[model samples]
Target: MTKPTTTPAEPPYLRIVAAIRRRIADGELLAGDRVPSTRQIAREWGVALATATKALTTLRLEGLVETRPRTGTVVAGTAPPTASPALPSTPSASPVSSASSTGTAPEQELTLERIVRTGMDIADAEGLSALSMRGVAARLGVAAMSLYRYVPGKDDLVLLMADTAYGEESYPADVPEGWRPRVELGARTLWTLYRRHPWLAQLGPISRPLPLPNLMVHGEWVLSALEGHGLDPTRLFDVHVLIYSHSHGLAVHLEREAQAEAATGQSDDEWMDSRAPTLQWLAESGRFPAFTRIVGSLGDGYDLRLDALFEFGLAALLDGLTPIIEGREATSR
Candidate 1:
């Protein structure tokens, strides 16, 4: 008799979490990679928003995904948990080298991946704020001027960084078996990648929609998802744009909170605590009864549940477009 191979059993949420965790451990999901939006997770895992949130929360607690200001939850790249442990204990100033210690021209040895990977390390440990031509050069122990040879300038470098990070995700090309499945998969793929490098959200809309060749497959996947929907080309464009906006809009908050924490070494809750006096004053004054009622719900303990908000809004948008989607399906058939 052949030996039986048994699959491991775990809860739905853990299974979902493990899927993400496995990617991270496998290096397929790199550092500074954005965690999937709760909506994306829910759709991918066929779980409820609450369960999805629990999965992301677990990742955040594990130091896997870090939220940054103007960015979203990004991969925490497995750098030393305590950076101080690795930083030079005593400072000594040496003229920063533009070339490696072996005296080889840094630019000559530079590959796109090398430049990007070094830059990512800086971003992961510090942040985008600390990333610049000179900063990345210093990290790589090369001359700041040498980085310019490859990067052209900081703006180009940042763009390349965003583009490179966006490449980490894999999108299925044949389009899923069903329109709904295809669309859900496309959105989840983009959202998962965005969750890794939330900074991509801040990079804004791509005017050409094909500037990043690597991301073209992703765009095609989204466009294909709308194929059977009764939407005209214009409406199809609008639908994809709407979904894209929703993901980035929520990501902006995640990025902001992450940046704030980095700057102050304080949690969002702590920052909110300092503002309590003002909030309390206003609440007690009762100048606006409606404001008081709503403000109470928005507390320091309150989180900007991006996933929940995304799901709620996405559902509403998709629901509202049902006639358009169904009409397209009917006409096609």
Candidate 2:
């Protein structure tokens, strides 16, 4: 049987849709087989719900799946009229029994596309530390060795997972009137995106980027925000890099706290209460009179409001950036 070749235009998610169609045509996804729900596909493919939904909807429209009474959406008994005529075939079309007889045909459906998706979800809910070939295979219900057929190593899997999550949203077609608004909007979007997959902030940028289309789009937008200031490309990119670094650097610790608290079943307040006596002892050391002055102002021991910290840092960054940006504007004029 000949294999299908992907075209330059084929997106990762659409490729997944085509692979699913092939599985249905080849009988691997038999009629009445429960198709994976959108959430599962998102987790499995590391694609966003929008991408997963689009793929499933494409399959549904093509007649590969249909909603049935007393059953959720499933593979239809008959291929939809719109299914590709050249849908690929697998061993399911002609069962093979030999030393090579794997339970499921080596369906191309289990492509790198699927591995990255599942890995992303694991990393998103847990953290990058939680993502592994063994973890992904467990989710796929396959032997750990089986995943080697897809992702090369845990590193490649993680890079792909990061890219897949980054592809979830699009930048605005046009920037707002001012750099302040544009940067604020863009930064907030990234913050929210990282918040959704809190592990994203923890992933280092050292690895070659995953050719993430959306992230590149965001880069273009950020560069445009600095356009009128006439900064060199390096400076423009540096500004963006520094701003995101500030946001994510702080967020990494925040997410770590969240994960730690969840695992240990201890709230921040509770943990701090236990540490209070030590903090008070340090405060009482009259050797540090200036430190005691501030503690007295709060009427309690050092109040560490992380939310306030994030806001204060954000405001300070923007305030500090203004002078530099104004200087560039002055030079440009």
Q: lDDT of each model, Cα atoms only? A: 0.64, 0.64
Model 2 residue runs over 4 Å out of place are: 1-111, 205-213, 262-265, 299-308, 328-333
1-333: candidate 1 lDDT, tens digit per residue: 999999887878788878899988998778765567666677788876667766766777787776554335567764333322121111210121222222344455765556666565465445667788887776666777877667788878777776666666666545457666766666667766666655566665545443676577677777877876557799788878776666666776655566787674335543454455677788899798998888787653356667777778767767776667778446656
Tens digit of lDDT per residue, candidate 2, span 5-75?
87677776788788888887887888777677665676788876557667766777787776542234578
Model 2, residue pairs in steric clash: 44-117, 44-118, 45-117, 46-117
Q: After superposition, how far is residue 275 of candidate 1 from its true place, in Å?
A: 1.3
lDDT of 1 at 197: 59
> Estimated TM-score per prediction?
0.62, 0.59
Looking at model 1, report the run of 10 residues with the lowest lDDT sum.
85-94
What value of lDDT does candidate 2 attain over all alpha carbons? 0.64
Which is the leading candidate under TM-score? Answer: 1
